[model samples]
Target: MNATAKLDEYIPVVGQAIIDDLKLLAERLAQKHVLHVNSTAVGGGVAEILSRMVPLLGEMGINTKWEVIKGGDQFYQVTKKFHNVLHGRPDEVTPADFEIFMETSRKNIAEMNTDYDIVFIHDPQPIALIQKKGQNKWIWRCHIDVSKPHPIVWAFLKEFIVRYDASVFSAPSFSQQLPIRQALISPSIDPLSEKNRELSPEDVDRVLAKYQISRDKPIITQISRFDRLKDPVGVIEAFLMVRKYIDCQLILAGGTATDDPEGLQVLAEVKEKAADNPDIHILLLPQNDFEVNALQRGSDVIMQKSLKEGFGLTVSEALWKVKPVVAGNVGGIPLQIKHKYSGMLCNSVEGAAFALKQILNSPAFAKRLGENGREHIRNNFLLTRHLRDYMLLFLSLDYAEDLVYL
Candidate 1:
């Protein structure tokens, strides 16, 4: 089937009722011009979701388009620092950083057109684009954990944030006390997409063999960008702690994004820490969805040890595959996992090691957690639900009553 036509196949997975509901919502949004503006067209979850969402919106007959903002290395570096600070990390955002960001924003403002019914800005990189807002509804979608942002950085971004008609956050904890109306909209995964789709036994084995990862021992994997916030070093430390008790291999696989300048530096640090540990396999993967799917399928345990995150889409992705995940107890991860019920949550390397051993030791218990996790994703974190929430948000903006004071 053609790419857009293949969306119909999701009906069987998400149920025909969901497809019907989405179609009904699309009717309300028929021909409405909605534009999505973000920093990059690839890498990270925002781009991944948009890559699938924009097309499906078109398939549903909405006049939708996606655009990427332009910036240089310095701009990305400043934004990376902004991202870190926004996640409550200590980072220096000097006046020079502000100048670089504003200069690039000016260029984008000059070169870009924004005449649409609704303009959706994703994340911090293209947030300043709201300056070009005219007679249109603009919504800022924050895909980060901003509950405890750096005071200076949050104060600076709040200037542009309050201008939007509304803002959307992935989880309630990620929300801020904003002036504009806000909606709690969780991000989602496409089960039919190559990244989360089912793979044949041969396909999974082939991917494992391609990476020279043996199935002889249980395989533990963590897939994410090699960023420090992901705490790759902590994952290695946790794996070392678990390794002292169990016999398994570690695969830290990920790719770099255009807007993340610190990827290579963080990757080098991880390699240095790994230090010729043959059992620890650090693979720098391309943005290949099928390969990612195969890697998740081939693994015995999955880990997402992020220090801070938006929703940690990797957690949901692994959950969708019915893989028992041991993730950091931060950000939106709690929304996905229900502690020892669906999956395990860890606060430190010791906690992670403890959870790892618990799952790795009991196959039956791990399988049950995996089953519960898959159902959780099926019920809450799929693409259909996200599309419905976004469509409803757009429709709500056109309502006659802005406020009702009782």
Candidate 2:
């Protein structure tokens, strides 16, 4: 879809007030050049947001650019370990890991273009880009939960992070009380995107048929990367418990990110755990957005069994589709779900299974929850809201004293 047309759809929902607000913000930041640096241009949520955000920012008269840092296999492996450690996992991040990270960061620093008014650095992979920051408003956009990060890893990264003018985190709980100013900006899904757009029943069925997913039985699906933090294995365990009472199938589908070196290993472990279970489908999708939309639409119950989630975009995507989601009550999952109102929040596999069974058994209740969930996302988690928040944040950085004049 074109940029103007896509932004117009928000008129009915967010109304002219926000559009006008964006216009004023755009005018205020017209001369400002914004650049976003991340690891990949696809696969991850940061990329997905930038794909829609940068274009809109440009359309709004801001000079916006997106750049990705290149890293080797070993570098990515080290970054992946850092990702886990940041999520509170006790991964042994050796001294060699920091050395490799610095080596790659040095290479990226030497070659990267850092000529922008505001530099937004996304995640840990490209975080070191801030090391090369000059006279610019460099904002570190951390799309992960570092509430309980490994001391060693956090300390190592802190050397580069503390240099930023500001930092953005998804949730308040995810934020660390650093000396720098912090902004709470939640991640959002594009409703007009292939993954959340309105789909016809024929399209949904065609997608299911292509994947050989049977519609005869109730399908409980979780769409996330095959990562341990996503808890794909725990999703399987929850599915098994749900299957004891409900005759349903479980679909765990996701694609790997370029920077995530542990995807294949995690996928293999998930396959091993679901061995010989025909009812369980482990699909390694090729980052196809529409297929994910169809799978969520075709499912009777959608789940996000994330043990540690950085807002869990899949949950927002499912909720946008009006699907009753049973997600873990951790990180940003609760921010998306209001428990019994929008959707049920689960703490463990058993809790998730129980919630899944409830949703599967009561169609009316599930439908009601789905409708409410969709409304919740429509009001709060859409790309338009995210853009507004970002624009406000940008303007705030400029008018640091009286920014809340709105």
Instruction: Give the local distance difference test score of model 1.
Output: 0.90
Candidate 1 differs from the real structure by a C-alpha RMSD in angstroms, to one decimal, of 3.4
Tens-digit lDDT track of model 1 for 1-406: 1245355788889888889999998998997999999999876678878988898998899999999999999999999999988877777789899999999999999998899999999999998999999988999999988988888888889999999999999888877888888999999988877787678999999999999988999899999989887999999999999999999989999997766679988988999989999999999898788999999999999999988787888899999999999999888999999999899999999999999999999999999999999999998999889999999889877764766332
Model 1 spans with C-alpha error above 4 angstroms: 1-5, 72-77, 255-278, 400-406
What is the C-alpha local distance difference test score of each model? 0.90, 0.87
Score residue 266 of candidate 2 by CA lDDT: 93
Instruction: Show the lowest summed lDDT stretch of 10 residues, model 2.
Output: 1-10
Model 2: per-residue Cα lDDT at residue 346? 88
Q: How many pairs of residues collide in model 2?
A: 0
Model 2 sits at a Cα RMSD from the real structure of 3.2
Give the TM-score of each candidate: 0.88, 0.87
